[model samples]
Target: MKVVRSDWSRALLVCGKCSKKLDGGFGPKGRESLAKALRRHLGLEKGRRAAMGVIEVKCLGICPKRAVTVIDADDPHAWRLVDEGADLDAVVETLGLIRR
Candidate 1:
């Protein structure tokens, strides 16, 4: 089996369906997807090389109005429902994504 090395401490799963439903309701101008916005906010590069991974996946089934579902691999017990144009700093803090 081939194994790839990564610098990621953890991974975040963002619901693509929810993001699409909201139609780019995140980021500074409110014109970026949750995954994209979070990546930019955290100063992370695409893929596993980043300190943490923010990946966009299909429907997570919650489908909250004006919100996107997010799952942090480190703490999967409680998922997050981020509202449109929510503060990225707060989200990062809540997810424990801050670099130590």
Candidate 2:
């Protein structure tokens, strides 16, 4: 089996479907997807070399009302539902993401 190395200390799974539904309800102008906004906020580069990973995933099955579902890899059992234009700092705090 092929193998690869990564510097990820943590990972996140953001719902692509929910982000699409919001029509860019996050970021500075509130026109960026959750994953993109988070990456920008954390100053993380693309690919596996970043301090952590924020991946846009398929539907998480819990389609919330005007909210995006997020799953922290460390605590998958407890998912997070973020509303439109929610605070990125709060998200980072809740997810316990430490910037590199």
Candidate 3:
């Protein structure tokens, strides 16, 4: 296996299936996926070199109504259910992410 390096201090996994269902339910125009919105909000570059990683992943299997599921890599035990257009700052805080 090839080893690579990243600047990530932590990782955030957003539910891609849920993001699809909501149809880009985040951001000012409400037309950006949570991952994209967050990345933009934090000024993060895509891929491994970013300060942190926000990856859209498959269904986490704990789908909630009108909400997307998220899991923080550092705290996998706690799953967060975020409603469409929820406050990004709050979400960032909940996920323990620092804004750049």
Candidate 4:
């Protein structure tokens, strides 16, 4: 097995189904998915090279209408539900994605 390394300090699992339902409810023109919005908001790159990884996955099963389900890998016990057009800064702070 080949060993791989990543710069990720935390992992965010955004529900794809929820994002799809909202149909790009985030970003300036309201035309970006939650994952993409967050990445841009935090100035993080895509994939494992980013400081924090934001990856979209299939339905998380706790589907919320007009909202997306997000799981913080560092703290999986609690899942976050972000409403459509929610503030990205607040989400980043809530998820502790900011490296201090």
Best by TM-score: 3
Cα shift from native, residue 32, model 2 (Å) = 0.3
Runs of candidate 2 exceeding 4 Å displacement: none
| lDDT tens readout by residue for model 1, 1-100 | 9999999888999999998988889987888999999988888899888888899999998999999999988788999999999988898888878743
Rank by TM-score, highest first: 3, 2, 4, 1
User: How many clashes in each candidate?
Assistant: 0, 0, 0, 0
Question: So what's the TM-score on candidate 3?
Answer: 0.95
TM-score of 2: 0.94
RMSD of each: 1.4, 1.0, 0.9, 1.5
Ten contiguous residues minimizing lDDT sum, candidate 3: 88-97
Candidate 3 residue 45 Cα shift, in angstroms, is 0.9
Better of 1 and 2 by TM-score: 2
TM-score of each: 0.92, 0.94, 0.95, 0.93
Cα misplacement distance, residue 37 of candidate 4 (Å): 0.4
Residue-level lDDT of model 3, residues 14-62, one tens digit each, is: 9999999999899999989999999999999989999899999999998
Q: CA lDDT of 1 in candidate 2? A: 100
lDDT of 1: 0.89
**Root mean square deviation (Cα) for candidate 1:** 1.4
Which pairs clash in model 1?
A: none
Candidate 1: segments with Cα more than 4 A from true spot: none
Q: Write the per-residue lDDT of candidate 4 for residues 1-100, one digit (tens) a residue.
A: 9989999888999998899989889999988999999988888899878888899999999989899999999899999999999988888788877833
